[model samples]
Target: MAAMAPSPGRGAHKHGVIALILCLLVLQREAWGLLCYCEGLCPDHNNFNGTCEAKPNSFCFSAVETVYDVETDQWKEERTYGCLGPDELGLMQCRAYLTKHQRPKNISCCNESDRCNEHLLPQIIHHKPSVAPQGNFLESLLLVTLPLGFVALLAVIMTVWFRYRQRESSMLEYNKPLGLVIGPNDTLSDLIEQSSGSGSGLPLLVQRTIAKQIQLVQSVGKGRYGEVWLGRWRGEKVAVKIFFTTDEASWVRETEIYQTVLLRHENILGFIAADIKGTGSLTQMLLITDYHQLGSLYDYLQNTTLNYFSMIRLSLSTSCGISHLHTEIFGTKGKPAIAHRDIKSKNILVKRNGECCIADFGLAVKYVSENNELDFGNNRKVGTRRYMAPEVLNETINMSCFESLKMADMYSFGLVLWEIVRRCASESGDRYLLADEYQLPYFDCVPPDPSFEDMHEVVCVRGVRPDIPLRWHYNEVLKTMSKVIQECWHANPAARLTALRVKKTLYKFHVSDGTKIV
Candidate 1:
């Protein structure tokens, strides 16, 4: 038996030609319905003119007119205008000789004007009649293109997923090679051991050591930038101020002011160590100073009760400290007139000897230029809102608006005095016995509400001032205190008493008394 021989190239060519012919036939059939008819050859129903003439309806007017009578169903020689078949009649109403009839269908049946109205009618291509596909061409194209588009989208998603998985795998490999994983139970010291073996642990250990060395015993107070901690440095009690590293410029300025001032006065806090030059970030910088265990004026007021005389002595000590900062001349440059931008009870520290000292130079700025113009443009609002002067809140004027730094300091000093008086007058228990013997009233009169405006408005606008209570009015110590508070809180900064004047006034008040002022 023999196998039949396979066809050669000729047979495949013939098959290809046949397929091409079939495709052409399908395309031709699809396009055949678009052909138009020859001018006068179509049947009346199919032609525009024929349909209008036969119907004699409103739609016939625009069709070409041929004389035809409906009743006889015959052609006539008479000429008529705008008498198209029913299909075109509505379109031909504007042509000459077609007086638009009320009833468009009632046209002449014969020669007589209205005689031909009897019911004349006449009239209107099949190539392939192909129905175009149900959807639009663009929509058909979209349907054919959708599968490829979906495949492309799927490919992109898979590529992204694979890349992400690969990166995660790489990260896991990198982390796993470190051998022993430090668990949550492991302390920082344990992590230091693990990291040290890999040469990455030393830096971490150093940071931890530095942080540990500076222990925060208690939070003394907090300000905008950071908080102050009563800490110990090398076993010596110290005040450690940990400022936010973000405010590097402010920290720099503050450090510069301290370095420039040096540790001169007994009442001013002396700087022992500054972390400004430390290797760590600025935020980690620790400002170390001698810690006065007596705490701040505000804290002292909270802990101890004092008679009017003791209160007066405390006020005098605070005034002396401020006076030293403002008036004590240092070097040929003279004392760089430093203004304690923030002066409240919290910033003043009391010592064991009952002497008060001014601390917290974070907001302090030196008036370097002789003009006394404070470069406050670079500074953020620093003082407590309650203690802020009205002018400070408005910030419309510069430091020059006040005649001297002492004047501004005095304004704050008044508030501090009032706080002292309030706390002293409110004391009870054994402290009250001591207070009573001093010939001081148990309680000083409550001061009027303070305005957060300019000192002028506080004095002139409000016409209100901190008054001495009737009980203490005749008392010499109370009288002196009343006078001092009034002078410190005077309306005009110029009119306000100077820190030096306050110190002098307190000295005279103390010297005249038999009791020793602390």
Candidate 2:
């Protein structure tokens, strides 16, 4: 059939009709394709060869389009399209198509021009779901640990606080008054009452049968052991010497020595009676002796001055007292001789008749036995250092020996004489007058000598020498006294003069006729 030309109106209508029919055919074909594609590529299936495959649990459905380069043979992504239903297998297929064209199958694509082949498709992978742990696990652990840590911290703080409070309480208890009683039933008010009741009254003496008869008037003096009191015994005023409980041993020893010797002389301090009662807390022992109202030689000299005549009397009295101890009696077994270990001024007791007596033979020891001599051992450094002889300072000399005791006593007596002279000079204002005139006074009158840096060097090597003034009142008397002191202070024991010689020399100075001045 040959083609025939139609009129213009007819041609236009016919063209319009043909166009409408073409549009309707395209629409129908598209609808049918869409329905088939949706069914085949459901989420549960893989869209291949017009069949569905089982989908994974984590799959999603979508459509994708891609284009392929003719020369390179590589697919490239164009556009993405989405489906409305859950079709996991179809989604994977779409992802594979997109991957093949550089656009994932899980993503939608645009048109047919972007279509790609199966060889370039990417494999779709399934992943397991991640599980988060239970929310309360860490919270529960923290809740358990935090409270325990806080409790431990609180316990430590409380322990420290308790200890500090306890220590403070103990300190307060210690500082409380001694009278405060500590007992289970005692209260703070009770303690206060007890403390208030204890006043500053004299402590009551523990009475014994012997002390009961001897009535103590008042305390005269106190010593390391106990107090000495002025007491009356059978209408006679006597000094009752009491010993402390702590010094009971010393008291026993002294009693033994006194009983053994049975020392009885006008110069020697007489022991009247010992307490018949044995040891007790307060009245351990008591020794009765005749009391001298003049007190100690030191006190008498300090209080009153002696004229030249009285000084002579005092010297004669003191010499006679010391000589009696050293003198041996005709009837005695070995030797009735004794040595006063301590010969200071205070030990010399002044009597009412200006007579002197030797007292305090506490440190005295008998020189008759070899055992007595050895009792001192290597201990030569006994007695007061100020009155100690130079030979006594030397360790080689044994002080327990009679010869050594005599020498030590001589040295002490020399110091005593010096003390008496110094006191007399001071009372007469001679020391100050001499000091002003000649710029010289007795060595002891000056301030104490400066302390030597090396004490051993000074004591052992450089011996002490007293500085006596040149312009003294009686130059002859001063020279004699200095010579006597020097002889007694000799470094060698053998060189030192004896106590008998010292007594004789002093006697010659002032003693004349039967009468004396003390």
Candidate 3:
């Protein structure tokens, strides 16, 4: 039988039915597409302001955040909602093994509804870890991270501009050369007082001027944090530490610590300027300070053998710096007690006059007795493993008590003093007996580049300390110095001598030895 042609009305009815079904399917897809409450949204239905629409191949995400109160050791909960971005290009490498996409541990993703995220149970968190990225994550992460970086840059610019403008306005009254000179006083602390009249350091105007005018001459040293360069500003030499963009937190923290009230001290490293320059990926954080040509105490000890007087002066100066940092100055313009968490020979710089100064404050922690607060700034860096105190190695140090931190520093200080004493020449009977060559603390007990577990075994579990030479016992000064080192590195932190006490004892030694203080 031959096929018959359909009537016009029938054909029209069939076409209308097909179009209606297509419209229903489109509406279903629109209903199912993931939409998330924008971040910072209260997640309350009645108070909804806006939402973030997930792009195709994405899901809505919700996260629970718990902010910590370091002072009180308390936590408070917060909520965040957003679209779960698609699998980054680098994440494609893990597709075969993993079914679920990577995200923050706290985040819960769903496609049920925009408010589905609200259904997630709030969990208390001390700290939130970022997603475990895989493959070429850095390359693929630029898409998401670049926007955050741009926002951070804008915030930094606004802060810098505000400081610049405020200082620029005051500059009309009086503009001094590089802030101030050392006048009659010989110390940089005097220079700071002459210029700003505060231990908070030079004015932002002076700092910016110095930063802008600085001419980096040669690379002096390089470390995990950054590179130190010998820079000059108007003929006066300065040390310019060039920090990578990744170390912004550490740089900012050190800058803040250096600017603390009454922070300037004769034995402390002088603060000159801190500036964030450049744009995009080329950003450089410059921390300018007074340059010491003699280099670090570690480098100095390696080449030169110190006499009894030189050792005393170095020890005295270093103790003074540590004491100043550990002591809290009270009043209207007061300074918090700071603990130099890392107190190795490398962190102490040698001045031209045979004195040493504490240089790095990146890992330093501040204690404010008024508020009962101990501020450990957001820095990922930790103390050197080789110099790690027993408490620190075993993870038994009390984070709340400031004294605990100070005691930990004393342990490291003991190690540094050991390094200094090792190179000291002591008079043995008729001839002078030169001390052993410079060696790091626990050199015999542990290997170079030790891990946390390795240090814990040697320092904490095994109960081993740097050996004291038998020759040190005969000389009066050397005997007293050995006792002080023993007291500083006591197995029990509570038994350790305070920085102030150590300073006093070292002063006594200097007086007994009949050597003048440097």
Q: Highest TM-score among the candidates is held by which one? A: 3
Error of 3 at 197 (Å): 1.8
- Estimate, for each residue in 325-375, the C-alpha lDDT of model 2 and write its tens digit: 666454433344567667877778788877777876656555544334522
For each candidate, what TM-score against the reference? 0.49, 0.48, 0.64
- Quote the RMSD, in angstroms, for model 3: 22.3
How far is 166's C-alpha from truth in model 3 (Å)?
10
Model 1: lowest-lDDT 10 consecutive positions: 123-132
Against the correct fold, how does model 3 do in TM-score?
0.64
Off by over 4 Å in 1: 1-218, 246-249, 276-282, 328-330, 369-377, 390-398, 401-404, 425-463, 511-518
Q: Which candidate order results from sorting by TM-score in descending order?
A: 3, 1, 2
lDDT, residue 262, model 1: 32
**Model 2, runs deviating above 4 Å:** 1-212, 260-262, 276-281, 330-335, 369-381, 425-461, 470-475, 510-518
Candidate 3: regions farther than 4 A off: 1-193, 279-281, 510-518
Ranking by lDDT: 3, 1, 2
Tell me which of candidates 2 and 3 scores higher on TM-score.
3
Worst 10 residues of 2 by lDDT: 198-207
Per-residue lDDT over 1-518 for candidate 3, one digit per residue giving the tens place of the 0 to 100 score: 99988789998999999999989866765655556666553334475566766555566666665555567765456666656556431222111342223232365667665556656554645543242344337767987899999999999999999999987777644445444533442344444556755677776665776688789999999988899999987677899999977788889889989989899888999889888878666888999988999999999999988778889899989999999999999998889999989999999999999899998888889999999998889996789999889988888888889989999999999999999999988875766777788899888877888889989999888899999999898788899999999999999999998888888888775343453322
lDDT for every model? Answer: 0.56, 0.53, 0.80
